[model samples]
Target: MPEKFDIHQPDDRFFKSAMSDPEVVKAYLQHFYPKIAAIAYLSSLKLENSVSLRPSLKRFEADVIYRCRFQGEADGRFYFCLLFEHKSKPDKYVAVQVGLYIMELLSSMVKKQGRELEPVLPLIFYNGKEKWMPQTLSELFQEHPHFIALEPYIPNFRFLFQDATRLSPAALLELVGVLLLERTQPNFVLIEAR
Candidate 1:
């Protein structure tokens, strides 16, 4: 067996390259995206080319986007958008950022096919030293004395959050090994070759 490579810096390039691998992505989804996994099979995943919806936004430049079809659902497909944050501290506006990305993805999908927008699973892969605390969009909102009344009007969305810093060593090694292999040879086949 090949030795596992350690990902010292989990930057945008690192994530984009690592997550491009179907195996790595499959493992990631299996572990982090339970809701999607329950509905869709890993074999059904097909990677799509990522587009930059907002070129002017500097922070949105390095996000990775993937589109795939569900195993049983023949008529519909969904997108998976991953945003990597390598900063030591978490961004307070992560919710808003993810929301914008989701809207952009929906708009692109609608324009491409002239059909109803499909679902988008926005995910944040944080590898910072600190533990990620904010799990939902509502958590980022400012608390007010009468916030209950305004809650209904707020545009809210939840993202699957994964903190690599929290993963066990064995699990991390598996993920990293797949990532390194995939990065080295994108066309590297798995089960199909066997």
Candidate 2:
């Protein structure tokens, strides 16, 4: 008998393994993460050991973190957290989850080394069949008389989102090519030739 394959379940293992590879991660960021690529060099990105907020909390299961030095800036560092969503349905509270994870990362750094809060860029990669509509934390909130008045007091944060299902075939092919080249050649520079 042939083995059965499940499509609805989240493949956290496969996503984590691919994102953990230095070359694959670098290529991914260079091609998909424009804002981050603008501030940091791909060569400077170093994958950090995944940190757990608590033993009871398994939020870090589908997430990967990277530490990188800011280009042309002394004493500048950035934390990039990539959270993968592989389920068929999108979570309505994904922003809240990401915000909590970011706070946990900051808290961990402060407790361990007393370092100043570093800027963290939270990115979400969704490959589900459903289209992701929400873009910011504020979007998930219900509009009410009091809520409208207190909007300024609420903590607002936005995460970069990429839906693989929406990408064109040519663009997907380009990304694949880039990943292959990067994997084969460690020193491959992604910058276009002058």
Q: List the candidates' TM-scores in order.
A: 0.72, 0.77
- Ten residues in a row with the worst lDDT in model 2? 79-88
Clashes of each: 0, 0
Query: Candidate 2: which stretches are off by over 4 Å?
Result: 1-10, 55-62, 74-88, 178-181, 184-194
Per-residue lDDT over 1-194 for candidate 2, one digit per residue giving the tens place of the 0 to 100 score: 99998754445555666677777877787788777777776676777766574546654643688777777766653433444333345888887777777777777768876466677777776777788754466665546557787778777887677777788987876766654665566676556559
Model 1: how far residue 82 lies from native, Å: 6.7
Taking all chains together, the TM-score of candidate 2 against the true structure is 0.77
Report lDDT per candidate.
0.64, 0.67
